[model samples]
Target: MLSESKKFRFAEDEEVTKKLFEEGDTDGDGLLTYEEALKAFSKYQRPFSREVFENYDTNHDGKLSQEEPETHSFRIINKYHFCGVFQFSNVVSLSHKQLRSISFFILAWQLLICDIMSVLVQFLLVIPQTFAGYSLYSHTFSYAIGSLDTLSYNGALMFALLLTINRLCIFLFPAIDQRVFGRPIIYGVVSLAWTLLFVFFIGLNATRCYKTFSVQGFYLHYENCENNSSSIGVIFQGIKDKWGRFSTYVMLGIYTLITIWLKFANRLHIKMNKTDGKQVRTNKKEIMFFVQSFIICITFLLESLMFDSIPRFKVYGQWRYAVNFTSNCITIFMFTVHSVVIFTFNSRIKEQLKEIFASKGKYYFASVTQTYPLQTTIVVRK
Candidate 1:
């Protein structure tokens, strides 16, 4: 009775309806409520209404439950965003490398995961809510995301320290490194890093509080209002900041000393033996490692400085929003640049990326050629 176009449209609508129903039934209890249906359909272009929901409740029940002859698909598709894909690729590339110590790789993985979380928080929470024409603000959400950003910054610093330490050990005391920084010891250090971060998070919750304030009836703003503004809190914050800066400087000094030592060591080796291919290769690797570490350390320090300089006093109106947005944008940009530097300086990552791209290109070219066969003309003499 229906035309072809009408039949196709009906099929498409049925498919979308089934998808919405499955997504709304989060508990898989074979039922959907008003609230669940609203949340599910709100993300889509359709306007969900109470009447529409009631229509789906064919049995006259308050809830929309699965009906007879309706088959539900329970399969869910998991996909990665840009940051997630990059994080996964970075981890995979690092894993393929044959390294004497995995401490650097482990720390790098932590940093990458932190950056991805930071990006996700901004894109999913901040951007969407800002653009959705919402006046309400949540201080807790802001603080949580800020804390995650700080954790990621600290992770970068720790990574730089780890790289410097590993290089120092290899160049200065190779024998002791094996026993001192064994797999178990390295694992313990990584665990300690995460444990300390967790403790710091707890401390932030206990010491600091965030509050929302109105700005001249123009807009609502959220800012940190330290609940414990006592000398103890100040001292604790100061100690934390000082420790981070001190550790970074110490690591940089150690790296410098190692560089000087390597320079002299190379000179002596050259004098003793004119040519050693293995030594040359090792030197090149060390050079690349040093460059990468240096750049990461600088970026980490700059980010720390930026956060430290952010005014604690309440900012109002567009200025407050502008400051916050700019700072977040800069932080994300720095994180991205750091990742690119790591990939650029590491030869192993370069080779892995090359292979990946090459294979993908070959597959794409093959598919295109197959889809559109090349036309060849045959010329015959008459």
Candidate 2:
């Protein structure tokens, strides 16, 4: 079964199989083969996204009614990120003091910063323009917004790949992990990646390749150039597609090996521990952490494909907006679910999150999706 709000409809179609992203293996044996696991992610993803949009619409009018987007979800996720960050401090918890020092935790911290930058673009530019109406001042300021958005987004993808590799190495090559992921070496690598990412986007910014609202005016346009067919546009798109494909394949590849190892290890341990076959046992904290990270990568992969494919599918008018909204849902879901998993896996965070939701107008990583009053009339933008 999938998690809350992610329960997928089962279908036998080939397309469904191709887009699959089942949560847990449905087998007497404790493992799901690669084919059975990720087969319906993109297929059912559309309708699942539609449901989310409905939850936001409130009036079922197929439009955003809020002045600011992602406010509730963003606050919840930010709180979780900050909690995880402070987990490393002795002042917060002596047991977690080493978290900030670890390379994995440091990379996670950087990814948090990148997410904030992406949210700033949404908070300042995209949401307001789409809701309140675009302004001359916003148009002029968008250059900087576009630049930061690109830098932060690509930075996130890079750091995610790094985190995946770091996790894999810790399992398979402890010595290499220690040597390569040492504090100085890890910081150096992250710095170099950042420098290269900035230089690349800076070159595109120089060529005047930037962004705009999408045709349906939902999400920000991926790339804006003199004309969509310009060489710079092609390069920008090519990089997006290739980078997306590479990250998906690498995450899938690394985890396949890890899954095999875990299965073998579990088999060996089961013989010694002697457990019942009927229990839906929770995973160890270490295993749970890895599983959560893998899920994040899967969500990112699906989100990228979902957004890119929207334009290509020739969706139009209101339905096009729905597709774009679905893409945004996936983007928020990816980040929001990360925080959810953190609190789920960590007792300290979980307790605080529980307390947060217990209070009125408060939330934790567990989504308290915000709602607002809406106008009865539908205002369609031409």
Candidate 3:
């Protein structure tokens, strides 16, 4: 289906492609040999296997090459593939340095989403509900907010843990990067998590929930009580004591340990890569990721620890409540900003941002160039 002028041609850097081709074809048979295959596999951060290489090389020319064995429309973002917005006709045209940068961005973006979810759930939904009665208008409002808070906090924490585990996996096993955390699995996990959250929290509330009503122009609240339920405020306090203090603290502890381990691992990674000057550029990224996690962990721990203290000392009626809310909001704000820090401080992300801008610039220049025309004018001189 190729036109005369629209033939498949190598549009990438020719020199780079030629060198890779030459190096890959080590057997002097005009094709890649098993040894060359091993080298290619090693370069891609995967273990070399002769059997796999032979199976992949369909030409039966006793040498391997970078031709597609299967006819597929979708590009695979596998170990041997880059699957970028741009394309190269040959492997040699691919820049390993740029590929690594993209890898870093992918990792950072995953972590950023988890942190954003954590902030949204913890600060906006959960923490506000911790107070005795932020939404005391009706039972429907109270139950709705309480259920949302529970779901958000727990779901966010679980998602954060998964993201941390995913980071560790990608860092250790670079070969199966796309396969390990592919789009299908990502979508499925997100859906399952949300579903579990709904069922878990909603089911719990369905059994031991309370309702508020107004009796004789006075507000009345009852929780699983048969006689004069409004007389006892113990139900609400019990709910708070169990879910607000104990459960939240448990989550905070787990997340803190995970964050600490992540920080240590990142530091150790930097130490190991001391000789690689390229890693120096990642220092800012490392610092930003570490600091953001540290802040979130500390904020969470502090907030969890202080949940009980705020109620014990009822120093200010309304003013104290305002200060408490403001402090909680600030912590949430830090967490939200933490989600975006990776994009801001990461060099790889910055590079991609520049590439996007440069691409737009090129488009505008091309448009202008096409519109303008060169003309020759005759100058009459005496």
Candidate 4:
């Protein structure tokens, strides 16, 4: 039942627990109100839903009294690794035509790989170093972790844009969709984009842009040029900081357009099979995939705001443990949710998962579904 939770409470310590309660208990009161707890959690970037808050406020009271902070378990990596790893594995083994025929799955597969690599490093090294204050780093560790951080964060934004564009073409501009996104073209687009992104960020490591980890702040910071705003670190950080909010707004605008297009699509005269008189429209399954992408995009929007709202609480000398736990919880959930949404929304992937596990890993049976996505064509009188 508890397999999914990454967090565990620290050992019982009244001294420390009382300090936590007092820290949360603003206005010099002994008990912490719901607002006090929420404000305190926001400072740490902790996930603070009403459900989570209610769980902490045991004893039927709406206040907290010195509860121990929660931290990551050793097995936390399993959550992301299993879902993402196996998703890729089945895709490769089965050679699923659903993914092979569509550009959306191509982008999603790349993003999944990025998430797996990012979470692997975070759970194994970053969590230990940040929370337990472990110094498990070689001289090369800085560049390596920094490269991963670059790939995951920056790579995700780019891939998400690709996915959004693919959806727009499928749902809104199907007339030029095939010419623009034929099998060879889409494959080339995603591969080249990822290659350039990888080469550019990893290439940065050759320069003076160094990423140093801070146990106090529990994140990596670039020391490429502290004083110069024109430094590599400063320049890169500025782009990342701005891209997230801008992309969110853009995606929202595009999604609105897509929604309107789909609503009025019946007004357009398009046909996949004019002989049989079948109506041409975006596939229902494709809409589900679009929904999944929407969830992830909205999540990134929230995550960006969380970071802005919760500046590093590095000054908490005695409350360092709570700070570590609360700050990392948000990150833990953020990466894990992508895979959860993927499996939950995509029926094809979910079915593939069931098949792989159902027969002890034998998966050669072909699906009876169509071998390819319907080539969207607009057949109307000029």
Candidate 5:
């Protein structure tokens, strides 16, 4: 029951309630019939069918009193509020744009560069070497071409590390994310990673090139590129193979550990009542990042395994050609697809792509439906 003082406080509300009741009482019988209530509600932009009105009647009375109207209003308000709560509770925000602190542009640029390099290596080197004669390039070009597979894997591993680090800063150490994980810092880290990769792998390749040229007085032979019969060549080959695989596995292991820890921490945060909607949303984004990382790692791993399984000189004739073609296709596909997937994960990039296509589509439609003015020449003879 509303007390007199409370009613006085809600006097304006009561007046509006009275107006609504009068509007619903179409026959002016001081009660709302089903049709009258439905019409009144529809005017207010609220859905109220006969069945809904019947539910509000409650006593099977065919008409609703003022008190019944107030009760129905309360029930409807509560029902919508309950639904809103459920929606909020189940919401999972996975938009990468929300993680703005992570430099998506930098990540995207790195992926793009790697993808372009993969394509160039495929067309300019891999295909020509496999199908056309392999005699066009000297030993240096051959060595660089062979090393591209390693470079692509390293590039992907670097990207995965960068993403993992960004997520760690955002979710675990958010207080310092702005200062510590700024764009400049991210840029420096990525630059340093590439520089180190070049110095180590490219430098090693250069050393091998020098050794082959100095000893054999010619470019490294495809038949015995490693010069594996010699002890020093065997050591160098062992180092090259072991280092490439070791670095990739180490990075993957670290990424896996970080992902597991993040999952555990997120669950614990929820259990401890420390998680809010924003935190939950961030967790969802992190999970999506983890999924993307997993895909990248798996694809790169498969490509690397395929490359290692096929020996350039050991296999003969059609089988060697087939293996080379298959491996090159798989490697190029993985790099290209990985870059595309990374771009799609960013909401801003996705929106831009959508807008570009939409504009083009509209233009195409207009061109197809265009009407041109017909020229009519009036005869001067008239």
Candidate 6:
């Protein structure tokens, strides 16, 4: 006769466990012994339960009960870990939210610095013009000056787009991102993006090849050779023109669509749950953050296009300088504003930042998503 005593099963806690046992216990053995359970768990790298085996052995038997018992406290799976936080106590630990926040800041700094540096180089190139040394300026500064500005602009755009992709992963695919970038992969990607940018832009397009047709002989209008073009130079310039414009437009278009969807969805979510003021507010803020990012991305691209397109409109001399300087300042200012998007939209990030600064202890990692058990029940029957 079957004993009417207590029966236990870890299978009660999770359905998958029950299925595994049903499948693995092939000989119609109603229960898994300690060794059997250990063997099953050994198949996976996860922990096995010695306690489960003993608990199932209710009759002081060496084997488990025919029926299973529920087990509590399963392993905590998928914990987020920041690189260097564990080993380097001096460095600040970044939670997922904080990492998103800091990524925004890094992108902003890249744009701000690149725009300023490029403009400074442009300004220096023009300094010789102020002292009646136009020949000297045109001879020495012509190639290097334009090349540097183009390189800086391209480098900043490439970096910012890569960062945008990172943000997208953080918001959309947090789990996969945590699994993939949980190691030093993030640093590796950043380095690779920058190196690719340098190789494609600065290294490839260092020569002045793009020719601007200018009338050298006043009144008569005679066409003169203004630039040198090597075989590699033409290829590089062609690639830069084509790829740069295409990438800028592609990024701008994708982000604009994303922002639109987020905005509509947020509005619908808020409308459906007016009573939940916090959720509504959060949704509104998230929508705004994404919209702001989209706008900034578009503005950055448009600004670059406008600067490059200015010469085509017959705009030249001090007017160009003024436009260039003003554009540089505007881009830098926009970058600074872009840096605050994550902070403004994400309260959790603000909280983590506060904790990071306030604490004397180790840096805290914040979870982007937390799981809540909807229900739990304990049944004791004898």
Look at candidate 4 and tell me the lDDT of residue 162.
Answer: 74
Each prediction's TM-score versus the true structure: 0.60, 0.60, 0.40, 0.63, 0.54, 0.46
> Candidate 4: deviation at residue 222, Å?
3.2
Q: Is candidate 2 or candidate 3 better by lDDT?
A: 2
Poorest 10 consecutive residues by lDDT, candidate 2: 1-10
State how far residue 266 of model 1 sits from its true place (Å): 4.9
Could you tell me which residue pairs clash in candidate 4? Answer: none
All models: lDDT?
A: 0.57, 0.56, 0.44, 0.60, 0.52, 0.48
Give the lowest summed-lDDT range of ten residues in model 6. 213-222
The all-Cα superposition gives candidate 1 an RMSD in Å to the true structure of 15.7
Top-lDDT candidate index: 4
**Residue 121 of candidate 4: its Cα lDDT?**
64
| Residue 268 Cα positional deviation in candidate 5, in Å, after optimal superposition | 2.2
**Sequence-dependent TM-score of model 3:** 0.40
Native-structure RMSD, model 3:
31.3
Of candidates 6 and 3, the better by lDDT: 6
Give Cα distance to truth, residue 214, candidate 3, Å.
15
**lDDT per residue as tens, model 1, 204-259:** 45567322222111112223434567775666565555766776677868878877
**Which lDDT tens digits does candidate 2 get at residues 326-381?**
66667766645444554455566556545544763444312323232132122222
> Deviation in angstroms for 250 in model 5?
2.2
Query: Candidate 2, residue 103: CA error in Å?
Result: 2.4
> In model 4, which regions exceed 4 Å deviation?
1-98, 128-132, 225-237, 264-282, 312-327, 361-382
Residues 182-252 of candidate 5 have per-residue lDDT tens digits of 76777677788789767655644544632111110111122343444466556555665565465456556
Give the per-residue Cα lDDT of candidate 6 at 262.
Answer: 59
lDDT of 4 by residue, 223-321 (tens): 544444556656655555577677767877788888887677734744445624223234656677778888766666666666666665433322443
Tell me each candidate's RMSD, in Å, in order.
15.7, 19.9, 31.3, 14.1, 32.7, 32.9
